[model samples]
Target: MQITFWGAARTVTGSCFLLEHEGHKFLVDCGMFQGNKALKQRNYSDFPFNPAEIDFVLLTHAHIDHSGLLPKLCKHGFKGNIWATEGTVDLCSVMLPDSAHIQESEVEQKNRRLLRAGQPTIEPIYTMEDAAKTLTLFKGIKYHQLVKPAENIEVVFYDAGHILGSSVIQIKYTEAGHEQIVVFSGDLGRYEHYILHDPDNIEKADYLVMESTYGIRFHEEEKSKEDLAKIINDTFKRGGNVIIPAFAVDRCQDIIMHLNSLVEAGLMKQGSIYVDSPLSVKATDIFCDHPEYFDEDTKALAEKYGTCPLKTKNIIFSETTEDSIALNKVKSGAIIISASGMADAGRIKHHLRHNLWRPESTVLFVGYQAEGTLGRRLVNGEKIVRIHGEEIDVKAQIVALDGYSAHGDQTEMLKWLSNIKEKPQNIFLVHGEESAMGQFAEIISQKTGIATLIPEMGESYKLNDLAHFVEKQKLAIDESGDMMELYLDINQQISQMMRAKEWQKLFDIKEFLHKIS
Candidate 1:
């Protein structure tokens, strides 16, 4: 048996991992890599392994960074089932296709330049058709149902509380004659979020793979709500447009909830608030579909108030392009929440271009901004920014509310790990940047005294004892198992370079590994 880190090892985007036991393979999460141009370029390249060879894909949530590459896998020929909660499936139905649309349009635009340069035009990574095809392979299941995705490999889903349908997967497998439990903490959510339920309890595991997106920082949840209200009140009083680039999934909904509370409490007027993104419109519907995933506070609010906060009067779900275009009509004191939270692309760019130059306008950030993204530049106080190929001076009030982040902070990450009964022989720190992962690695070693390895992309750790148990257990390999083949192909493609270069490919391989494993 072996565990390979393909993606999200030392950086925050493109998550994939592979587990091989007894010649059978299983994938953990297949997320898309995001941020800087170089990282985004990787999304256009082929998978190191054959997508068709993967047996099964275990999904964690619906965030594009976690599950955006599914359409590409399907386009490349993966035919196995994708297991996820019902909410996750529904979210993907909208997200994956949207991602495909973005890719297709991007490729088309890029190909024109390539063709002019006398280079052969390349194909989009995947098409909307491929995304449509992938949707049929999704198998929706309830949380905590112990089922074997493959023979002798029991899989269970626990609430991660990161977003609607988010989960932490508990995997119990036998290799050789030994039993091992491997837990993948998909993206740990803050204990108390505005919309979703609290993160589920940590189950015991022999091996635990956890996320450390905010491992180096501390966030105050209460202060964030207060700050948000203050920002809105200040902006409304001054007659400025408050523009927020929020992720349509959790952050967008959460912000709306906060705004709704402010309006009801009379701290802020019920000013015109528009959620201007098609993805957000669909996402809100999905949020309404699953009341089971809501926290007690959210449930009580829903019961007491007919519609959830942000979905009612004064808060408009701007679904159509025309609706979004109509926002320009309201020039004063209007609040617009758009998508692509990092401000890399999407409707947020248009909003920024229109409002960032206004001294009274405010661009309130309430999510994590990966390095090299427009959001990070804004946070760092870049005075001028380019939007859709035009440079615009940034004169608006820029405020970042770190407390509103969905990912657990450094203390929370450690607290979650402390819940585990015993640390396994190996602990892998992933889904974070180098700084965050390094800090997390050091703290885990000091606190738990466990050997933690952050593998570079495509790096393989041979489990001599674990492999023996895998053979002893003789788990069944279904026709769906393409994961092993993919891993082997990736290894073969990068091994020479990986060894000769001494970890140059480590991060890239880890990002790639994040997809299938």
Candidate 2:
């Protein structure tokens, strides 16, 4: 048996781990590649392994970066069951179809631009039919339920507390009288979050895969709530709207909970909080549907409300296109929360187009902004950006609430890692940037005496071999009984170009690479 870093080796998105044993293949988190133009283009690339041969998928969460590719997987002919927590499956029901719509819409938009430019039209990765088909493959299992998906393999799900129904997948496989337990930390959620339960800690694992998105940083918890209220109050006082680009999953509901608290405490004014994304509106309902997944405080609050704790008295749900369009007309004394937390797509783009140019308005970010995303550009203080193909000057205050991140920070991750009764032989860090992973690997080594391993993209390490790793110099293909060499030269060329571009200081490098790649 061996494990390969199929995706999310040194980057923060696109998490997949390929495990092969006894001529059988399985995967954990066959996620979509997100972030930069290069990374997003990888979504259009062929699968590293034949989709038909894969036995099963162990899903960790419903975040697009982690679960977005299921439709494409199904589209490509994978008919295996996808095991996930109940929350994840529920979220995916709406999310996957929404993703398909985005894919079709984006491709259509691109095709229109290409048509005028006399360029070739492109195709979407998958369609609504594909997403609908993918939904059928999902098998919802309760957390902590011992699942025997296949012979010699046992799977269990633990709450990661990252989002509603997010899980840390634990897999135990016995082969040749030897048993190995491997745990995949999908995405660790913060402790004492207002809505979700804390991440569940495991006692032990033979080999571990962990996420390190916040490995090098700690959240600034002090005064964030106060700061949030202050920001909203100040924006409303200035006769402007508070525009928040948030993910529709847990972040949207969490922000609503905060808004509800603010309203209940009389911290916020009697202004409207518009949830402009239908997906968010649906997700909020889903949250209410699964109050069993809520934390103690949230559960109590939910029971008290008898509705959804995610709902606020002053909040409005924008369900229709007309409702969403009407929100753009609200100039002041309103808080508009939209989806595509990165502000790269969905109704958030329209909200930003209208509000980002207004000096009185504020665009607040409450989640991690991946590199090369519009949200990152805004947070990095880009003065002007193009939305809907028009350049808009950014005069609004761009605020990032440091404490609102769903992921746990370094200290929390360490605390969770320390709970293991016995230290694992090796620790493999994935789902983080290269620098963060480096610092975290060093920290783990120094603090716990465990040899931390950082696997590069497409790299593989045999389960029995601790000291050696096989780099993907031969090809970029994942294991499918035998390694295949198809995109080696092209991928190598692209990798070289990316490295060279990184080493050089070029202001137009992003646009240049995007155009060519």
Candidate 3:
């Protein structure tokens, strides 16, 4: 068996990994690239692998950075099945199309600019039509379901506790008459996530691929609710609207839970707070539906409070376009939470467009914002910003609270790795920028006496007998070409995948982007 790191190799966004075993090809994730505009432009580039050649895809969760590129994969040529948990599939139904719309709109705007400048025009990375086709290939698998991934590969999933249906996937593949277990800890969640349950512990594995997003930094604030309460109270006393651009899935619910706790403790005024996303409201319902997935503390909180977090009197769910528009009319001190955490698009943009120029408003950031995103630009103290074709001055105060992050911090990451009694032969750290990966690698090596490899994009490593043959091929292709080929192949494979008979086993695509595999 051989594996190659594609996207999210040296950087955090655009997560994808290729694995080959017994002549079968598969991908762990097909996320979108983010950050600088030059880097995000890679999304418009062709796939490096044959999309149709990838027989299956194991998804981790529905975060845009992890699952945003499925439609492009389908548009290129992939027609295989995408396996994910049921909740992930459901979330994709809402997220993927929204992502597609963003791409379409963005491309159109870019082309218009080029047209005026008399430059060559470009098409959208993928259209809504392509996104629609991609949805036809989804196949839902419940957590802990063990099944064969390929000819001689068995796989199982454990709750990652990152998002509603996020998972940590374990693959047992056979090569050279030996069975090896490879575990992919897809964006491991914290042991004390606010919305979802704690991450599950794995017994053992021959090899492990882990994320190092916060591997270098500690979450400074342990009292997340206390800090949140303080921020809200300070803003409210100044008679300012607390504007938040949050991811509509787990983060939105998590914030609500924290706010509920603050209200219950009488630390925060029970003022009107609006969750203004239909998708978020639906996702909250799913969170309610899956009580079995909750951790002990969350379950007990639900039992003791007699209501889920969002059901409180101060909270309002805005589900209609009219309702969202009407929210602008309320000028008093209100907490308005909207979607697209990065503030790139969605109702959050509209909210920011209206409220950002006001001195009596506070924009609170509770998630990681890619470098080019509006949220990042604002947090970095940009005085002027463009939103929906209007230039607006950022007079509102900006507050960033990283404690609300779902991913485990450096301390939590060490704790998780410390649980392993026996270190594996090799540890490849993926899904983080160079600084983060480098710091974590050094830290892990020092603590565990295990050297970690931070693989570059397009770099490959052989695990069994076929290692020599693949390494020789790796030598034949330039590193840059290999990376391009990986994406090009993905494009070609997914485009032709729809014609295959076993497509159902991989996915039907009707549901959405599923896993973080």
Candidate 4:
């Protein structure tokens, strides 16, 4: 068996992995590229392998970064079944079509400009019809249930506690008469996540493919309700609206629950709170329908409230374009929550265009912002930004509450790893920035004494000869004369040392390099 790191190798988005065994090819995730223009442009690039050749796909969740490319995969002639949890299937039912709409809308807007400039027109990556067809291939599996999507491979799902029906997948396969177990940690969630259950603990695995999205950070312990209330109150006092860009699936519902609690506690004044994303409205309904997936606290909260956990007193769901446009009339005392958490697209951009330049308003971020995203630029304190091709000065207050993050932080991820009684033979970290992946590799190596590999994009590993594969990789890089590769490798080593605070070792390495030069 062989594995390839097609995406999310040294970045936080575009999570695709290819597994080939005994002439059969399968995919773990067919995610879309997001964040910076370089990464986003990758979405339009041809697949490294022919999508038509893929036998099946093991979908872990419905997040766009994990499952967004199913339509494109289907459009490219993949006729295989896509296996996922029931909740994931339901979420994708709405999300995929919505994603297609966004793509179409964006392409249409870009085409107008190109038409005027006499440039070639572009097409959307996939259409709504493609998304609809992709849904026909979905085969829903219940949590903890085992199934085989291909010969000699058995798969099981564990609740990942990330979103409504997110999962950690385990694949049991046979290679050369040897049985092996490989576990994929599909965006593990926090232990005390408000809506979902804690991530399930796996007892054993031979190989582990884990995510390291927050590998170098920890979630803030401070309760975000107080901070949110203060931001709202302060903004309202100045007669401005609080515009929030949130993820439609998990973060949006989480924010709604928090706002409901604040209102119930009388900590927030009663005012119009608009959920402006149609995708979010549908996602919230799906979330409410699956009460079985909720944590104990969330279930109890639902019981106490006598309604959905997300339904607050002053909440308004705006489903139509006109209704969304009407929100612009409310200049102050309104809390507008929109989708596309990174604020790169969707109605949130329109909302930002109206309020981001207002000194009295505030733009609150309740999720992780990938590098080069609009949210990252705002959070990083860029004074001027462009929205809808118009440059706007950023006068509004920008705030990020890390406590609302859905991904488990470094400490929580380590705790999750400790659950495996026996360490895996190899641990590969993906879905993180280069620096975070480097820092995490060191921490995992020290804690478990297991070999950890951070595979670069297009890198491959043979499952049967893991040690030899790693040694070959080390030799290849060590023997290479490419200055840029050497420089990056040295920088990663220095970063790891700095993170460990080993000043002596860092100084010694720098001095040794200087002497050798």
lDDT of 2 by residue, 330-433 (tens): 89999999998999988999999999999999999988999999999999999999888688999999998878899889999999899878667888999998
User: Which residue ranges in model 4 land beyond 4 Å of their true spot?
Assistant: 465-517
Q: Sort the candidates on TM-score, descending order.
A: 2, 4, 1, 3
User: Could you say which candidate leads in TM-score?
Assistant: 2
Give the deviation of candidate 2 from the true structure as CA RMSD: 5.9
Backbone N/Cα/C clashes per model: 40, 0, 52, 0
Candidate 3 regions exceeding 4 Å error are 224-226, 304-308, 465-517
TM-scores for all candidates?
A: 0.88, 0.91, 0.87, 0.89
Candidate 4, lDDT over the whole model:
0.88
lDDT of 1 by residue, 29-72 (tens): 78888987657666766676678788889999999888988888
Which one wins by lDDT: 2 or 4? 4
lDDT of 4 by residue, 41-94 (tens): 677666778899999999999999999888999999999999999999999999
Cα error, candidate 2, residue 503 (Å): 24
> In terms of lDDT, which candidate is strongest?
4
Q: What is the lDDT of residue 420 in candidate 3?
A: 57
Model 3 TM: 0.87
